[model samples]
Target: MSAPDPVRCAVIGTKTIAGQHLPVLQTLPEAEVAALCDIDAEALGETSRRFGIERTFTSVEDLQTWGEFDAVYVLVSVLAVAEVSERFIRAGIPTFLEKPPGLYSSDTERLAEAARETGTTAMVGFNRRFYTCLQAGREALLDTGDVVSVTVHADEDAGDKWFGEKFPPEVSMRWAYANSIHALDLLRYLGGEVAKVTSVVRKRRLPKPDSFSALLEYESGAVGRAIADHFGPKGSSHWYEARTASAVLTSQARSSPGDRLSSCTLERHGREPVRFGLTGLDRRLKPGFPGESRAFLRAVQTGEPVSFPAPTLDDAVRTMKMIDEITGAEEWAPKPAS
Candidate 1:
């Protein structure tokens, strides 16, 4: 195929995270915001003008029923992700979806099947894997040897940002899938496959009973755990970390909506105790989004699949299974016939 012009992309949500995505998409050399879609007619017009998007719609159906964008990015609500993604994937439009593909593993099955049938590329949002910190963590594991174990922590201040409804309920619990999956997938990303998960669930900080710590037994014979809380004291650190025999790696970002300051620390112990930390990181958007979006653009333009991308739908399903076990639900397992 000939070198394609800049990938004309359409974004389907203009909410909080989508707000960040619009500007970042505008900055990518291989991307152009061809259209914007949101249920809020007012917000749609505002984002379209804000991003200089010429075409706008208040519905994904209108965008897909008669749309012409080169690719689609499904940034809709968690409950609506699979349905929206399935619409585009069956239409054979290369799609990039946001995190937590669905509240349950079953929710992702049709989209995965459709992607296979249509031969269209579909990717889930797992930007943490692309973070420079986790990127180095994977390599740093080589020196550590044996993949002993890993630990990840996430802290959120629900002080005033606590809307209590930013995320809807699955009635089966969406907190872990909503984001603990970020750290869960991170553990899997750096440590390897998971064999078993044992987690304690309880309400610690948040307005909801969604905080807990989980022990992970990796299929590679390594042990790890991750803990998250949405309500913490103001200025609490929100970061993830992993440790190896030779060194420990940590990633933390300063709290500023307008600007980003992140750092990764590696502490080594041996003949010499050396400490390495990377500072002044991009914290506004996800550290890995640019690279992730670029990979999508490459795949869209070349008609090739994204190579070893982080957090595929299947991968998210496996993580969801682990979460199910953590919640004592075990929804991923084959059930007994009624």
Candidate 2:
């Protein structure tokens, strides 16, 4: 009998996250980074050479039509994600789209519809749920009484141009969508679906609004609060904590030298706080990325179901919708300078 065909995979963008994705794909025995696509030739060249990829395409159409990849990792900006993802989904390629699928709800819904119609499997890159501490936290919450309130603190000194030049200028201010999206995904993952939100935004020192805090009410009668700020003078960082009738979960605020850390700690009411140790998943071994990638591939390969903790497409849409509402409300806007 012939050996099963290898899973050919392509990376759709060469940005920072792609930096994360490419390394991981290399570790999967069943997967290969067959193609690299990016509008920037220089970035494409760098990635192609680093990964030893022979095929590189500057256009999405060309890459989608010419590549032999069975799956694609869509790691481009949220604005461009829908367009590129739709192309791959329509082509019958399984996809692992980066989180917060698109800048708007309509776009993400359209992408979801395309995936459904074409029978293409898709997964969102909400990586935090896979963190060891968080996984244990969820297990702890199962027997604990209903969650009452949650507080998430995420601060990153994302230097100038932290997200790179590809992101649309308007949405670049602060990490309301970029960084907090992860926490927002976690909030829903732990506390339950958010039913309403009231928020306020501030731009203390940065050119764009760089700080925000919100109050969230969940469908399960739980309450949540979240803060995302980029005004720190120190290096990048992140922290999150959740409170329930039985326990509390916390995460240290620390990011890698150049990369943001997404770690957490879960503190039970009467027990010690459980810390998800530094994810030793080397960028070389592609630990976290490969872990999620392999899980997705296994689900596709075996027809088994893959479950996610938070920020599913639907959950992300709900979070984005809440952000839109908070950002648009006159009461939530910053006051005019005196």
Candidate 3:
């Protein structure tokens, strides 16, 4: 008997994030990167050639029609996320949209409704929840039931060009939406769903919004603090810490392009402050893009669950709502200068 055909997949948005998606799809034994699409023809051709993808298109609509893949990885900009996602959903294709899901709750809700009506699998890409350290932390905390507070610090050297050309003044406010949503989602993943958030945003150094700090009150009576910054010196670091009554977990490492990392520290609380020391795991925790792609393929083939702790469309919408609250809060208004 002939073997079953591999799952045909196409990647939309051939940017840096799309670069991550392409490799992941190629690694999946049950999936193949059948097509690639990008507004930039140069990028489209480059990625297609590099990845050995034969079909390429400059428009998602064209790609969708020609490629006819079972699923599409939507990795475009925040502004384009919802529209592109809705298009595929209406076309009856499952989609794995990169994080934030959409620019606003309304857009996300629209996509969510479409997914439900079409009965297509829609998963949001919040990859942090898939990390080995995070997975261990989740299991440890759940077993102990002693987590009280969690603190996280995430800093990105967005570089001058990122703030200047990537985000203009009019749309700069979305920096918080596009970047910090992952950290905010992490709070919900680790602590429990956030009940309320008090947040403050600041713009420093480069123009546009760049920094924010928030306090999250979780439904389980746990409190967490999250800080995200993109305006920092080059070679900056990403640090994350989770503490419970019985243990404390920490990771400090430099973030590479695409915010990937090399190493991290995991600590267990002891009588005097014993350090567990630094250990090196696979630089690509969760295998970054490839791991997620494999998980999606598995879910499709065997009816197994996706490996990552992904946000549903509804969960992503709610996270966007929380971001809106933080960004639009009256309490976060700037004080009068002396």
Candidate 4:
């Protein structure tokens, strides 16, 4: 049979994250960047010109009215994700939403409901799940046996350094959901559905809860530990580990220095460890963006489900819910200056 037509894609945001997606989508054989949209005309113009995309719009309604693309990538801010992605899902277009999928688990739930009601395919862009190193490590871990335990240590500067008076209260207060979810999702991705949060320890910080440690029990009887220390002295670092009886897998953050690529290792009993890392494409574009973009476009082009590890709206809902469990909803709410 002849080659399938590329999936014409429209991007709904032109910020840093959107820039990351656009490059991969344009390079993919299965996708075409048909149009670009952003409320900020200057940013839109710059991104459109950079990518050589002629079609541009300042509103989602205008883009929908034009409706020339087969799939839409919603890379808007955390607050706008649910609203924008829901519009496309309601309009019967496949949508690729950036991580978090919404400001809260409820927001993701609403999007999931809309996708189900409209019968449109939707994916939440948990790019880390698409990391080639993580993928290989995950597979190796499973080959050894069941995943008995998984640990994720995500570190960042304090709340002031993170927000720096830039984000609105809504976004800053929900920082864990808006940002930390990227690291937190790895827990569910590796271990499985969390049955209960057995213990939680939080270091109270005024504007936001800056440190947290939680013990998780998964539905598969796996134990999980997620520790996010925003007050750490280290600038920023992340380590993800998953273990089976016979093997262990570990990876550094994708943005690690010297190569801008994650380093991963898999070790089995009585065997030398197997080491792997990201490809040049990952270094060229944002790590994991290329794979995640291809997976989303492939699903759109062929009507097949977005491959495993690329989270769907339903999966986002669970991940977000897990965030709520790890960091109580009350703590995420911003308080007025004293």
lDDT of each: 0.69, 0.68, 0.67, 0.82
**Candidate 2 accuracy as TM-score:** 0.82
Better of 1 and 2 by lDDT: 1
Q: Which ten residues in a row have the lowest lDDT in candidate 2?
A: 329-338
The candidate maximizing TM-score is 4
Question: What digit string (tens of lDDT, one per residue) describes model 1 on residues 47-116?
Answer: 7777678788888888887677899888877777877888888888999999877666677766677888
Scored by Cα lDDT, where does model 4 land? 0.82
Tens digits of per-residue lDDT, candidate 4, 254-318, equal 65564222778888878998987876678678888888888887788788887578898889888
Off by over 4 Å in 2: 1-5, 141-143, 157-159, 162-168, 206-209, 253-263, 269-273, 278-287, 303-306, 329-338
Q: Mind giving the per-residue lDDT tens digits that candidate 2 earns over 1-338?
A: 75455678778889778887776777667677788889989999998888788899999889866867778889887667777888877887787888767655566777778876877777777776666445655676665767888776656665454556755554455256665666656667677778888877777766666677889888988898877666667644555667777776666545434333344566666776666553445434433565678767765665544556523455566666666654442233322343
Runs off by more than 4 Å, candidate 3: 1-5, 157-163, 168-171, 202-211, 234-237, 253-266, 269-287, 303-308, 329-338
The number of the candidate with the highest lDDT is 4
How does candidate 1 fare on TM-score? Answer: 0.84
Residue 324 C-alpha lDDT in model 2: 64
Candidate closer to the true structure by TM-score (higher is better), 1 or 4: 4
Task: Report lDDT (Cα) of residue 223, candidate 1.
Answer: 85
Q: Considering only N, C-alpha and C atoms within 3 Å, which residue pairs clash in candidate 1?
A: none
